[model samples]
Target: MDSANIVVVSGLLIGLVYGSVGLLSGFCLLSSLRGFWAEGDGRLVRSYALAIGVAVAMTQLLAAGGFVDIGKSIYLQSSFSAPVMFFGGLLFGYGMVLSNGCGSRALVLLGRGNLRSFVVVVVLAIFAQMTLKGLIAPSRIAMVGASQTTTTANSVPALLAGAGLSATAARMLAASIISAALIIFAFAHQAFRRSPGQIAAGLVIGLLVAAGWFASGYLGADDFNPVPVTSLTFIAPIADALQYVMLSTGSTLNFGIVTVFGVFAGSLATALLTGRFQLEGFQSPRHMLRSGGGAALMGAGGVMAFGCSIGQGLTGFSTLALASLIAFAGILVGTAAGLRGALRVRPLAAA
Candidate 1:
């Protein structure tokens, strides 16, 4: 097939792996943090850290080996609004708490017949599209335009290079330091090390992120029709997938859209095989309202942030971009606020 087709197929396979791993191991940032801070279980969070470390190492290897030019991805853009991205991440993080999950998690849950997640996914998609191209677009654009700045040194490696390190040396130093630190943090926890399933999840998910880059950057690099080089991100892709469902006659298939479908399918197949598929719904109107509101927040915030948790946290971070760091910090802070402090989401009393 052509380059576009190749990339689309690759996205499907990657998404399938992600969905299976996610369902089996429950790999999610929100869940990880909740488990760590609330329940005092650090294993899940360690898995997430390991995933990030692996993604950074593998993605950088691809870039260094000339297999992919990740600089072409959105994370490495020359111009971006740090303030806006941070605020957006903060909103998304909080929303994840309210909804009890992030976009990717919701998709996995939906595959298992959680009707509540169906509402979350639909509302998130609608609000994301609005922020991207509907009513919220103008306001988002204004916010970005007011604070966005252009910089040649948008990444850690580039910053090091600016500080007198050679390009190759800078890249190596930055990637090694960051990846090693994350991997160390992950394995530092004995509980996490013992959880073979979580470890496998981390390794697989991390490799999938790099695979996404390779699929889009290398396989889809057509002379006449190049595709955007991106990895596993959910926000805009979810929005695009919703639109494609509505406008398939006029729309064309792309990597992100297909990946979305593949994730759902993969999770569904796994759920059925494991006898885990069960119908579920909101407990009360209050629950539905909170879930819907959270979805809306995620949609809009993800648009402003240019990614969701996985989008910015892992995929963007792999690029070692300064903006990703800022956004990631914002997300962590927001998550902490929701998990603790006065803003903490108290557990619902039994009905």
Candidate 2:
């Protein structure tokens, strides 16, 4: 009934929608890129592009309508460490390929009874916590402190406003240009257009991101107990969820933690109802080693970057923050390294 409760409920519902859609549509950035580059299938990537486009448009609209103060979100911080964020994205991107999925994807797979994903989720959470508040925290803090820079313009819209455009005009112009570009790219592919399922996935997922902003920013705007404004992100939340499981007495429930649980539950229910639940595990010790290492990288990198793929790629990007752009670029480069060129991770031999 209260603002906090509204946010909690919204998080759960958002997670449920995301999980269900993810399971049904196989919506994942890594999978999309891999399919495009390796298999020459552009449908998945197009879906991702469309999602980003829609998210940017809708999120900006909310900000323009005074429904959300997106400037308060982490992505738009005036001071940021570009080097650290970029490098973190690189690590996360590479780790994603090695692990065969990102955090959200791992959660979905875990719900489908993939024991390998179970390992990935646990290890990723542990390392994410480590990077966030444990042994790795000091080093991460040092790196950020050393390289951080402050700027008047932290987002594309802000930059445009600085260049003589009115604030409102700047926001609309920047959002329109970027969103239109991505949408055009997405729809240019006839194959993607033909896949109504992927189109729906993109639209729904993008809308859910805006829904997240509305939930935390508007609905949860309490005078005395204001909630932190956030959208769909998995890295720190997964870590926090793990911590909550162990320290329930001392810990408090937040949107991120609840969203993690909701994602698992939604995916689990979907898997069972769709007859897709199947037990699976690593083929060998080597496989386990690779998966664990990748998860660790993702955890650490995601923290340094301040988000995972869905976190930065979609949610952060939706704000048009310059830092998100840098991180997203780093992720793309890292993914490319893992998927192609000399640094590409070769597939393991069949056990």
lDDT over C-alpha atoms for residue 1 of model 2: 95
Best by lDDT: 2
Clashes found in each candidate (C-alpha, N, C closer than 3 A): 0, 0
Cα deviation of 193, candidate 1, in Å: 1.1
* CA lDDT, every model vs. true structure: 0.93, 0.95
TM-score of predicted structure 2? 0.99
- lDDT (Cα, tens digit) per residue for candidate 2, span 41-115: 999999999999999999999999999999989999999999999999999999999999999999998888999
